[model samples]
Target: MSQTESTALADVSALRADLDLVDAEIRALVGRRRELSREIQRIRQASGGTRTDLTREMRVISPYTEAYGRQGTAIAMALLEICRGTGAPPR
Candidate 1:
């Protein structure tokens, strides 16, 4: 390949590696969030409260929505689904 083509390929490879690293970090963070959410769910259930609270969830979704617009809202909802009580996480 020409030098320019090789350089572009190298840049793309580097960017893809960076994206892989980011994906791993996101997975770890989501796992941590899931653990924390489940703990909160346990505590709340023990205290006779509901496991999921919509008001608090709205608060959690707001910043994500602000950052990603509609996409953020969808992302936040997906996170919530995966982190809640027996399923995924929470707010």
Candidate 2:
């Protein structure tokens, strides 16, 4: 390959490495969110509260919506699903 092509390939590899680090960070944060969500679910059940909190969810989604526009809402909703599970009614 030409020197220019080799240099471009190296840059792409470096960027991919950065993306891998970012992916790891995101996975760690998602696991932490899941743990926190489980704790909240436990407390809510103990206190006779419902599992779903629309108000709190909207609050959680608000900043993302503001920062990223429509895509932010989508990302927030996906994160919510990851942390809280689908909105399936309790058995």
Candidate 3:
């Protein structure tokens, strides 16, 4: 094999390794978020408040959109669906 071809293969392998590491970190963060959601559910139960809060949802989503440069509205709506199913309000 040519030297350049071997170098390219090594570079690709390194990128794959980095991606795998990032994937694992993403999974961990997602799990943590789920736990926080559960805690929120418990708090709302204690307070006798609805599960969803549209205002709170917007607030929670804005920063993520700003930081990540994605569609905050869509993500918030999807989460709202989950919250609704859990007896949370749109707001």
TM-score pick, better of 2 and 3: 2
> Candidate 3 — which residues are off by over 4 angstroms?
68-91
> On residues 1-91, what C-alpha lDDT tens digit does candidate 1 reach at each position?
9999999999999999999999999999998998899899999999999999899999999999999999999999988888884553334
Q: lDDT of all predictions, in order shown?
A: 0.91, 0.89, 0.73
Tell me each candidate's TM-score.
Answer: 0.92, 0.89, 0.70
Local accuracy of candidate 2 as per-residue lDDT tens digits, 1-91: 9999999999999999999999999988888997899789889989999877989999999999999999999999988987786656334
In terms of lDDT, which candidate is stronger, 1 or 2?
A: 1
| TM-score sort, best first | 1, 2, 3
Instruction: Give the lowest summed-lDDT range of ten residues in model 1.
Output: 82-91
Measured by lDDT, the strongest candidate is: 1
Higher-TM-score candidate of 1 and 3 = 1
Residue 16 displacement (Å), model 3:
1.0
Task: Provide the global lDDT of candidate 3 against the true structure.
Answer: 0.73
Please give, for residues 1-91, the per-residue lDDT of candidate 3 as tens digits.
Answer: 9999999999999999999999999767655766687678779978998765668878877876887667766666655555445545334
